[model samples]
Target: MPKKDNFDEARLAEAIKIALAQKKPNIAKIAREFDVSRTTLSDRVKKAITPTTPTESRRNALTSYQERALVAWIHQMCNWNLPPTRQDRQVGKNWAYSFMARIPAHINLAPVKQKTKELRRI
Candidate 1:
């Protein structure tokens, strides 16, 4: 049997962008239009999109101002109580860090680690 459709960050983002551009961030509308469940569509859109450590290095990247804005926006939009520290901003730009925090915690909001060997491999 074919594996179930696992929505990717890119697709979710596209859907969100399309919805927003159309002046409709409505979960139900987007879900129905996209033929995806409302919960799944919401989860995908809310999930952070970042690159792994090595990918970050390979990209010769630095924490851009835009990235910081994204972190701030994510905090506000998600109602994350965590402060936007410099370290948090830096780590939030990385996929591993974002992905780690994406794992549902009790609070649904927490500052992810800024550094990790395993994350570098990811």
Candidate 2:
């Protein structure tokens, strides 16, 4: 299964821009030109619609900004050749694992180490 969003958000944004630039915006014309939904463009122009996806979850212990800051601090620790295993003051072990999962760039090192050890054994 291919993992990618099907929605043409950039085109929709352009339609919204053109609609707003007009003195008397024509939602229907702009929608047709940009191949976007008339109702969606109109709603966006009027600021009547909210995002489909909620950015922050209610169950999260820390905010997104805080998580980013924590990641940056961890990266800095790594740059200084220091171990980055002491971040459980405000979060739990599960939170740490989930945080790693959420970040696509973070690689799980356990499996890699195991593979390396097995190769060394062979």
Candidate 3:
């Protein structure tokens, strides 16, 4: 079966830009314009598209700002007496470190299951 996400990845911002420039944005119409699912377009907008695809380099690993934010969030959770479970820590580490290097540009969210699958292959 063909991959569900087979379209060009580099043009997502363009599509999003086109969608938002409308005076009265319509998700369905924007999706048709970009040849992507409406839900996909909606998600990108909601995320503000900070995080993007993953890569293999480590130079841009985690910026100091991002690291501090993550660590602070983790510590905050602890202060709340609602410490994250093992899985949450794993996710945090995976994202905070260079494992997310492969992600596309400006994408803040990580696909945990997909990362797990990649880890297994490595």
What TM-score, over all chains together, does every model reach? 0.27, 0.40, 0.35
Q: Which candidate order results from sorting by lDDT in descending order?
A: 2, 3, 1
Candidate 3 deviant stretches above 4 angstroms: 1-5, 49-122
lDDT of 3 by residue, 5-101 (tens): 6676545667788766775678787777777767777777766646676663455445666755655665566565554333434244555344345
For this target, which candidate reaches the highest lDDT against the unseen true structure? 2
Q: Higher-TM-score candidate among 1 and 2?
A: 2
**lDDT score at residue 27, model 1, on the 0-100 scale:** 77
TM-score of 2: 0.40
When sorted by TM-score, best at the front, the candidate numbers are: 2, 3, 1
Ten contiguous residues with the weakest lDDT in model 3: 108-117
lDDT per residue (tens digit) for residues 39-119 in model 2: 777878888334475568868877888877877877666666566776347666687688777866643323211123356
Cα error, residue 90 of model 1, in Å, equals: 30
> Model 1, 19-117: lDDT tens per residue?
656544687877667665677666655553333344333342335455555555656744544444443444335765654454446535455434444
